[model samples]
Target: MKNIYKGLILSLLVLGVGLAGCSNDDNNPSPDGKDYASLDDKLDYSLARNEVDFLMETYEKDADRKYHDAELPTKFTEEQNVFMQNALTINLNHSAPVVVLPMLRGIDGNGEKVYYIITEASDFKMAKKLGVNYSPKLKYARGSEGVQKATVNGDGYMVFEGSVDFSPVRRIEPGTGEFAFPPSVAQPGAVGDENYSPIVVLPSNLVLNATPVKNVTGLHDRIPEGERSLDLDEMWVTLQILDGFQGGRAYYYHLVTDAYDQVPATIELGIYAPKLGKIPQFGQSTLDEESALLGFSPVGNGIDDLQSDNRQGLSSAILSDQNGSGSLAPLDPINVFPIEPQNELEKNNNYSPLWDAHISKWTDEAIEKGYQRRITSFQDLKSLVDKGWVVSFTPDAGPVNSYVAGLNASNAIINCPVIAHPKN
Candidate 1:
């Protein structure tokens, strides 16, 4: 009996040792020999509202300044990182970087209260300091009824002449064709009045794009629990809670789609333009200096190429059917621009809101050989382009005898901030 007891104790000790070894190995490698780590493991997600409060306080103090051309930090700071993490947690499924800005309340032509978020400030320093992109070209958007004028009040809040109506039911139906190039009908949920444009000129001659986020009040109660998404036609809205000096305050964060980047090419589909003159430069930093971060070669003399209404920038890239039917269809009117930053290093070094645009078409031999398929990655697209299975072109020079895609001009400017790139 004594011998049996001793033997059992030894067996248990050996089992425990084996289990410990296995647990440690599990952390280092998987069956496929890939080391996996959760986002939580790599990042600290502790909430820090004081950081945001400090930044906002600084911005308010400098609000009355006439010019803000001072150099600002380009890289993310500790405060910015904290705010980004908290904002990203509101919706983990977001495809683009989530930017959270302070909402300015105003009464529209109607007596109801509306909220707007500022993106591009005409002052390059102010724009960078606020963590938003700069657009000196917004100065030209003034004088149009499409552009709304606003004044910063004593409380540092914006007072606008009119507001956007976000209660419209947004819908889009793709055409019955295999590619569904042009949607049978498409409508954005939010619409501004005749006086409303995304561009807002301030009292200090500072022009900025103030995009509408929410119009109706009490819509928060309608959102389901554990679900933060409130789809508004093409745009999405999510509520965020911040613990500031004023205590807990709720703000709305808007998620807008970005122009899909196809390596050396950029493709744009939509925009909110009340008139041709109201179209602001999509990703430019200043009027004279092109963005060092975003590589782009404009189609014509800058924004002038898009002035004509007849230009319909459509690409011949066929959308492949998901069910393996191998049917081809025309793409929607997409404004393609030639871009640089061909590799990950260039992308990381000078990452800008501006994306390079390219038009890709499958070659006749590729389609005949069944080598044409949907591209899954930047590498795959480049590989096909190299093998002559696919041919790429500038917006000005498309495939021979093809239908005229739209003009090589940007039609849309999505307010999406890039957070991180995937390591594949």
Candidate 2:
């Protein structure tokens, strides 16, 4: 009887050892179905505002490097990464009034887990507590369906989740009244289409120097969230390509927004005169020296040619081909009997719908400097050269002047003052 009891005890011991071995398997599951060790220890998600001190310290040490590297999250959605970057950036700014909120766990569009934060941009006292030098004000906007929104003082508001959209950014140049547009997004509407091209109404007194191209259009400005339409005076001088130059169809675009605060209407005409044209001196071009005929040199790469590193001799071979005859011909008007071909300047032929002023009022200084001639037609432009008066042109830099020289021959207008039509 004692031996039978011993055998039974041995069998029980063996069975207990087998159960322990099964419990210690690498694939053993926790209550959440994931391996106990596989779960992230740092993510103690049950606690609201989880581990703020530790998270902030971790972010403060490594956030910049991660942001710069565009390091995305592996366990979370991309939007979470954007939120982190935005929070870190604003919190770090010495002048911005902001504080980062703790991570709140959530799910994204694909049902994947993500983390996000709610920032306090409106609290100046919080900014002071963070050691900010100056408390900058903030504007708020309702965020998009899946993204967060933030505002910059001069750059307008930005929307981001994993990426940023800058379509709402707008800028106004202080003295020149130059406008940087905030482009609009296309929306699906149920009723009549509300979309329209950018339009500007000019003061009724200004006459167009040239026959303005009929098809030249304005930009499409979109209103961003948390902001109203711009009310400041803004203008843009741009060039438009109609068809191909090879097909002999191209024109310049002169855009002007209405004057506010009694700012007098003026035009800054940018031009594109190919150096290959023969009537102008061969292999000579300058925006500096005044032309004998026009008050300003009639040449430019147009707005399309602005470059940072500076383009060189781009059109020399083409312009230099026929000595001078190969240069571009002026846009000549058709079906006007009394109008001569030489007088068919595009500038004089086109005027904007907003142009209402028939007489352009010139400043006293301009009249004294012999630049007060009223340019009624192409004939008037020729008269400037016929009278032997110096015509001014402005080249932004030396490389542009040098490039112009290769086509026209001389770099006469390299350093001329930028031509401006001062207000009356």
Candidate 3:
């Protein structure tokens, strides 16, 4: 009887192990599943209505086609399907880290330009926003620079940028205890990432250029009063963004100087909504407003921790998150392009400090966010081609410089990417 009992217990343990394995099998699916399946269906076009309207206006005179679901009426026709397939092939040439040309492009039958477009920015969603230009446009000042955060997308704030140390300061502040700079904010970088070190600096327009002096305050009227060379010197002007009511706006960053004139090879600019003043420059955001289609989170979580090893349940996490709806978790994809040489502006201005390492993407929580990563093992040149909604092109070929130009034109500090994203 004792021997029989022992054998029965061993059998039960084996059954338990088998059940656990089956459960994991049921849970796991490949990453990029939805994105791949959507591509296969060829009907998941999501170009925005306004963009569609623009396209329609551009090609309405032609009698060759109809329109349905914001697509050319004959979008499913054989010729149209061929064109779409070709466009997808071009887009999916998956050689890019951030999915180059994240949209569909084609020519209308009338020989007019027809773009199956996606909106990098749109005003349709309430409280949606983007930067226009640098403001308070100061050249000189004292202490703390630039403004950020605080719902500055609507009509009550002004977008401002200021210069600081040109060298990238990775450890922004020592001993993490809330931030010292108020009215201004910057996104926190990982403890260690081959990060963009930006010294916060004052903008060229803020104050008159002054030599490094001692004990000076930004936006103060007394700097001109002193004649001594050693009194409160000005070095880096704190950059700031003004937010709040038009008449009562306050400067979030106190716009001052870093104790010297010499800055660094790189710099970080601050953007924010200051307390209101005479003129309202930027807008306000609220829970009442809809969510941004884009998202921003540590790429390591999605791109590194998850994609690199397919560790634990990472791929399954991506699939489940992108099942359909959206969440605002930090795991969103921010677009990033590897800084390449031979670019004119990067060479001349050398202003990489102004760029963020990650561009924001369509946001959702960890549970709802699925990774849309594409990896390929290339043994040859042609292997660099892109696949699906992911396309990559090498600048060496023709330097489709237009791609860079489009990025500049959008002035997109970062674009939030969408998973199973709708076009617009």
Candidate 4:
């Protein structure tokens, strides 16, 4: 019996050693294969990124064909002329590049021309002096930072390019938490998943010239915020359309920022896509309007401590002076079913009647008080509603406001929806 136990232990040890050998062999492949130790070796070692590389190559080819006519200037003088022509049309006021020319051959090798485009006949004449024929107008549309999310596309690719303005850095601060629908809002009814979109928080611009963050685990997570000394000015953001528009809207990221500080900021600018209408900038006002329109319902038993009873369900009530005679009436509570054992997996799921109740209350309020529109720009999302339809993007200070008020107020120190409600 002792010998048998010893044999069994020996067999297990041998198996473990064999497995370790296989793992080591997998981790350290031949020189021809991916080298896990070297960043340079892994830079081009991606099967999935091959598609993106192909897309990028295809984009450069298309750009060259569209602008460069698939040819580089033969002479240095011609290259200089092309460079200067591109430099003239640069719109410095915009936070992003509207038009950019690929590298122009220079005595010092390939060099980029900033804000360079031939916008007029005179600019062409100037280029003609150097014996180069340049286009008088831009060949590509000046919008679209589309992102492709679909696995396959039978349709040809559609590209988008947009200039994001982070000049208002205060508005795009992180932790502002004003990008998407407030999660605290009660969602007890039949709300489709398509209706909610990720509100990404990103720096208003990429610090391409900032000092790079070291020891990044993956390329996807790294932010090369150029030099630490330079302020984050602008970022080149690109979005692509996929699956012929059914895939989703062109809102590329939830947020973009270069600020290293831990403060929360939000991206409140508008995104334009054919299917998404104008991506409305969601703000505190919108949250309040949504809450009122949603009739303040309690979130699923407070996010913390799931085992506790859903006492927070009581906060869903909407108190108001219905008759306008100074006497207020509180609406009845929406009963939330206890989190059943079978539904334990979906514990975080919202089960409040808040959304439906708010919709009902909003319709009634709109009918009783009529809706009003307060025209505002993307820069200012403050809403202008007192009790009825809050049309503006300003922050709301209602009694039944959610944490958005506190977060937005805190981030106030610094710092979307379309008509066709998107699916989950």
CA-lDDT, candidates in order? 0.35, 0.19, 0.19, 0.19
RMSD of each: 22.0, 29.1, 28.9, 25.6
Per-residue CA lDDT of model 1 for 1-424, tens digit only, reads: 9657534533432222221222222332321232324211210101111112222443445333211222533233432322222121333222222333344454554656655555454443345445454543344444544356665433334566665544444344434653333334444434445665556655334555565556662222112231244433222344322110000111112223222221111122122334322333333422243221122221111111223322222322112211212121112232222221111221112223333333445566876786643343344445665687766433343212111122122333333323322121
lDDT of 2 by residue, 1-424 (tens): 9657534533432222221222221332221222224211111111111122222333344333221122332332332222222222222121211222223222222233323222221112221222211101111001112112111111111111121111222221212112110101111110001110012000110001111111112111211111121111111111211100101111111122211011111111111111101112222222222111111122221111113212111121112222222122111110000111111121221111111111112233544674533233334433543454422222222122222211121222110111111111
Best by the lDDT measure: 1
Please give the lDDT score at residue 141 for candidate 4.
Answer: 7
TM-score of each: 0.47, 0.17, 0.20, 0.19
Q: Write the per-residue lDDT of candidate 4 for residues 159-231, one digit (tens) a residue.
A: 1121122122122111113222222222111110121111110111100010111111111011222133121
Comparison by TM-score, 2 against 3, better one:
3
Off by over 4 Å in 1: 1-101, 137-146, 217-277, 280-407, 410-424
- Residue 368, candidate 2: Cα error in Å is 1.6
TM-score of 2: 0.17
Model 3 earns a TM-score of 0.20
lDDT of 3 by residue, 93-184 (tens): 11221111111222221222212222111111100111111111111111222211111111111112221111222122111222111112
Give candidate 3's whole-model lDDT: 0.19
Mark the regions of model 3 whose C-alpha exceeds 4 Å error after superposition. Answer: 1-295, 299-413, 417-424
